[model samples]
Target: MNIKTEFSDKTLTAIIEGDIDHHTAKGIRETIDLAVEEKNPSALTLDFGNVQFMDSSGIGLIMGRYRLMKLLNGNLELVNLPEHINRLISLSGLFSLDIIKNKGCEQIETRE
Candidate 1:
């Protein structure tokens, strides 16, 4: 899996590509955590547009990040989720965590 991060106006966007399984989750988590610590963004967006597959580890990754953002009084958004992954997230009860969804053209305000 490849993880690319973009920081703008205190918002850190991590565009994740490829499958997220146990093998890749550790590296992905470390990368994202480091970015979050460095940027200290008030919001985070995990763009899963290119993610093809995910296992339970993916859910753990998301949950962990959610906690991290909450601790910093920030927010976490999940965008461009493929239908299968969306179902997995929903089935995992992750929706109750107040994960923001980017639908359509509505942009997420990062700085102001």
Candidate 2:
């Protein structure tokens, strides 16, 4: 897995690519957490557009990040989710928790 982060306007965006499984989730979490602590962004956007596969570990990753953001008085957003990943989130019952702040946006647009 590969995770890239960008910070601006009090928001941190992480573009995650590849599969999110038990092996990769932990590394991704650590990387994101480091960025969050350094940037302290009011909002965090996890862009899953390039993610191809995900298991329960993905749910864990999301949950952990959600908790982290809340603890920091920030918010978390998931975007650009492909159909399979969306279904996983729904089936995992994450949506019921309202973890996804902006479900209307199919993708997070970035400024060049």
Candidate 3:
């Protein structure tokens, strides 16, 4: 998986590509958490526009990040979620998922 992170105005944006399955979730989470520590952003946005596949691991990734952001007194947001990924998260009964300002977009355009 590829996770490219950008920080600006105290917000961190992670553009994730590739499948977010058991094999890649840990690496992706580590990379994002490392960036979170380094940037200490007030908000972190996970962009999943390029993700072609995902599993329960993806939900775990989001949940873990949510906890991390809470511990840091920051906020976590999700965007550009593919339809399947959106459905997965919704079915997981993660109420916070719907609160994300940018959630439910079948796909969001990216500069790249």
- Best candidate, lDDT: 1
Clash number for candidate 1: 0
Regions more than 4 Å wrong, model 3: 97-99, 107-112
Give lDDT: candidate 1, residue 39. 94
Q: Rate the local accuracy (lDDT) of all candidates.
A: 0.88, 0.86, 0.85
What is the full ranking by lDDT, best candidate first? 1, 2, 3
Estimated TM-score per prediction?
0.89, 0.87, 0.87
lDDT per residue as tens, model 2, 23-57: 99999999999999899999999998889899989
User: Lowest lDDT 10-mer window, candidate 3?
Assistant: 103-112
What ranking emerges by TM-score with the best candidate at the front?
Answer: 1, 3, 2
Highest TM-score among the candidates is held by which one? Answer: 1
Tens-digit per-residue lDDT, 3-59, candidate 1: 999999889999999999999999999999999999999999999888989988999
- Residue clash pairs of candidate 2: none
Query: Could you tell me how far off, in angstroms, the CA of residue 2 lies in candidate 2 after the best superposition?
Result: 0.5
Minimum summed lDDT over a 10-residue window in model 2 is located at: 102-111
C-alpha displacement of 91 in model 2, angstroms? 1.1
Alpha-carbon runs more than 4 Å astray in model 2: 101-112
| Of 1 and 2, the candidate ranking higher by lDDT | 1
What overall lDDT, based on C-alpha atoms, would model 1 receive against the true structure?
A: 0.88
